[model samples]
Target: MEKNQSLVEENEKLSRGLSEAAGQTAQMLERIILTEQANEKMNAKLEELRKHAACKVDLQKLVETLEDQELKENVEVIRNLQQVITQLSDETVACMAAAIDTAVEPEAQVEISPGSSRSSDAFTTQHALRQAQMSKELVELNKALALKEALAKKMTQNDSQLQPIEFQYQDNIKNLELEVINLQKEKEELVLELQTTKKDVNQAKLSERRRKRLQELEGQIADLKKKLNEQSKLLKLKESTEHTVSKLNQEIRVMKNQRVQLMRQMKEDAERFRQWKQQKDKEVIQLKERDRKRQYELLKLERSFQKQSNVLRRKTEEAAAANKRLKDALQKQREVTEKRKETQSRGMEGTTARVKSWLGNEIEVMVSTEEAKRHLNDLLEDRKILAQDVAQLKEKVESGENPPPKLRRRTFSLAELRGQVSESEDSITKQIESLETEMELRSAQIADLQQKLLDAESEDRPKHRWENIATILEAKCALKYLIGELVSSKIQVSKLESSLKQNKASCADMQKMLFEERNHFAEIETELQAELVRVEQQHQEKVLYLLSQLQQSQMAEKQLEESVSEKEQQLLSILKCQDEELEKMQEVCEQNQQLLRENKIMKQKLNLLQVASRQKSHLPKDTLLSPDSSFEYIPPKPKPSRFKEKFLEQSMDIEDIKYCSEYSVNEPEDSDGDGGDGDDEEWKPTKLVKVSKKNIQ
Candidate 1:
């Protein structure tokens, strides 16, 4: 009972274990299904992203747009500022012209009054000539003042015309700035969203079903890994690719550094250009003021000449007798005036030439810088492309898309990548050093130019000031052009930076994808391993159960054989006992047959003796029928057979035979009365017959 109870308990436990295993398997399957669904969804999302990649709001494009817009606004502002500066210059020129006219008028009037007083005593041809010259000078002065007033009025009109345009441009700039800010905010928000998505993806948990599928997936993973590893040629290809990529990366880094240096140089150039522009603007303003002063001084000189002519006319009338002397003096004065004009013209020409030469040099410098910047930009673009290619190669390496066949190959690839990266870094360092040297040289050149400008300013002659003013105006125009170029360069730099940022984002995205793929592969491998373990465990259990069942069957068969053999042995023993009993009954039957034969013989002899006695009894009754009849019967009877003596005489003589026969018949009936052990009692008649025979003997 205890054993039965124990078996029942074991069966219940086994059933529970089986149920638990089945449940676990079911859960595992469910998890696997869920994971598969998730994988499908992820694949769909990837597809969607691919499809929309172009359509998406590219940050680089937006940044470029903003930069372009800003550059445009800056250019407009610079243009407006230039216009204002020109207008101011014009106004100053007009004011100087008016001042010159005023100063000349007063001097001419004072001199004419003195000449008129001297000529009061005489009205000669000399007086008339003096009056005519004075009138012509007055008219010229008045015309100059009128022209100056008209020019000032035109400048004012131009200023009024520019005011509204400038205001409108300012408003437009403000609106563009606001839009740029909004776009920047949007870009930041998008970046935050991207980060959140990445975090969520990272935080996602593995499902139970996926865990269960791990083992089943192992074989597939092995096959895939095997295929990935089988390409020996690919390993060499990968190595070469890595080398190329490394070389490219190094070249790219060198180029990038060069580009950076170029950009820095451009920035320095732009700053210097701005400074030069400011200095030139200041110089232009100073020159304009000086030119005005020079104009006023020239007007004063003209007035003095006009006054001298009036005084000479008065003296000529008074000293008509000394007309020849007066003529000689006038000739000398004319000669002196001619010499002074010639010298002034020469000075103006020389100063103008110098200023033009300076401007040409500055323009040449600007053009050279622009060309260098363009060359650097082109190099930067080339470097950017190379960097992109290198990044692609790195991504391919990291992605393990065509993984190396073995650990050694993988290591080789890794080493190659590292080597390439190191080489590139070294190259970049060298390039940077070279660029730094170049930048220093350029800086020195700029300093020299600045020093030259300072020297020119310090050594400038007073007479050449007007010439300098004209040169300053030309320089201001150059500065405006340079400012525009600077703005353009700045825009280009911003575009490059934006491109770089975009490339970085793309590279980061690719890295993320590679990492995800790697993680997925690892997860799959783990799942496959787990599934394999579970399957192996299940197989082992099944094998154990089958083995146990086989053992149980063998044991049952052995027990059955044992029980069958025991039964057979028992049957044989029963058969032998029955055979022994049957033989004893046969012996009793033979004895009974013998007793029957003896009884038959005794009956025949008794019949014969009875007949003889009956016949003799009629004639010799007195002779034979005496008291000794028993002796006469004994003499007549043949000696009873041994069978009769034993069988009949043991129990009965003639009477004993009858009694024994009757007793034998009665014994058989008595033996038949009880049925228990009846077969054993069935031979009792033979035993009784034997006993009766012994008693008869």
Candidate 2:
């Protein structure tokens, strides 16, 4: 007390309420950290949902394989035609060799003329044999020419049909690659956030460890202070007692002087001595009691302090473990983000390769667009030439003139052979329709599968059950593969339809050509009027039957037309519903992204608190942010211990920023301020979408 008499009043003036509020705030901050973690988890889920909504599946390989199958089928037909040609060629060659050998030896045939008449017969027979061989060779050449022509037609049909679908497939693959890249970027961002979180957690653990150690050291210092206070009190009490005793002696001396005057000198001396003895005894007892009470109080205080220290140690351990776990999680997140980015890049590359392959390599099935147009022009020119030739023949016939022998001898109906192009149009139409339907159904089913997965997770089902469901979904994808055959068949049908339309036009040209040819044939047969008349009747009957079949097909098309119109209306309704759902999904994704950003910021703030633990002096207002906070939102706080700050900041700069997700809705609904549902009307749900862009920190 004597050594520091001026400090007592200053120490007594600070109230208890302010200390309590500081403690409550510390606890509040801890809860905030926990909340931020929850927000991070929520944000991740939201991001996943957003990705699922926007994600597109790739099917390029399947499409290419389908085209290959078509090529194979077309090649099969060509192969059959080639085989027929080969057979005819072999027969012709065999027949030719026999005729040539026989014709070369007419002398031998004459030697057998003793049977001279028989020899003449043999020579005549050899001539017949040679003539038969020539006829066979002619037939073989005609068949080979027909097969070549048919192959050319098939190639043209396939090239036209698969070209559009291949282009569309390639485009879709490119879009998917872009989406994958975006998703990967998002994942990388998340991972970086996680890494920052891990650093914060580690810092938190170190700070907590330091805090516990400091608390222990403070407790020990307080114990020492208590001992020092007790000793000082004892020293002061002893000094005061001595001072009082000295004063009492002086008073006794004064009393002795007075008593000597009042009583006898001997009585005064005895009374003073007895009183002094009794005072000494009383002082000794008081000192002993004081020491005992101080000792008891110190023992009780140490016990209470020790219990608190133990509790603090346990808490410190728990906090350290939690911090480590959080740091680990953050590290994992960072790694995952990096991996996601890498995966995205790889996927993009793969997609590009696939698109290029589909478009570039499948040449046998489809030619380039330019080539198709050119081929079309060529076909038109060919048809024109055929028509002109037919017209001239018809004119000659109409003039009642006999046709030249050359024209009659080399009769080849190229127009009749090319009418098969109509089949290609039918196949191409069916292919496109089926492919579109399959794509739509697959997309919808994927959505449904994702929804079911969400429901299962929300219901807290076990992993095994979800796995079973996943298996079922996989089986369905397999089922789609099995349906590939049907899809391919539809593709063929579409191609056939396209071919049918083109061939129909050709057929019309062929019909005109046929009429001209018929006229020419009629001229050739002018010497045999009955024969010409019979052939004409037969041809007319066949044409009439074909026309009847065509009329019936038209009637069938009309009936199907009404049903298709209704289905198209239904498809429109479904599209609108999908748009609404996508809108909601988009909103959720934005919220998740926002929440993640907020979590990262707050985690940095928690880390700042750790750095603040070792601080011994106040920090500047601007330099206290952690890395997670965006540049503008960091708040400044006074530093407590400079040593802590110095050691923590040695390896890494502490930005000391804090993030709070307290913003409002940022929904992409009616950015024009209204959903365009009304004009000059009070804002309502119908007219305006209340997009609450909440900060989901």
How close is every model to the real structure, measured as TM-score? 0.25, 0.13
lDDT of each: 0.49, 0.43
Top candidate (lDDT): 1
Per-residue lDDT of model 2, residues 1-697, tens digit only: 7544334323222211222222233233335435535744754564454345222322343344555777767655655554555565456445534533443232332222122111122323333333333333323332332343334334443544545754564565555456555545555554454445434777668656655655565565556555555555655655565565555556545543443342232234334433654564565456445435644644563465455445444544443343344344434434543554455445444434333332222221122222333333433343344345345435544563321111221111233212322332343334335434433543443344334334323443333322321234334543454476469879999999999999999999999999999999888778478776887888888888888888878877876786787788789889888988898677656656654555465446544543442241134435544464234442342233432343243322233211121111122123224334342132112111112334321
Indicate the worst ten consecutive residues by lDDT in candidate 1. 403-412
lDDT of 1 by residue, 290-312 (tens): 44564464466446545644553
Model 1, residue 318: what's the lDDT? 36
lDDT of 2: 0.43
Total backbone clashes of model 1? 16
- Model 2, residue 146: distance off in Å is 14
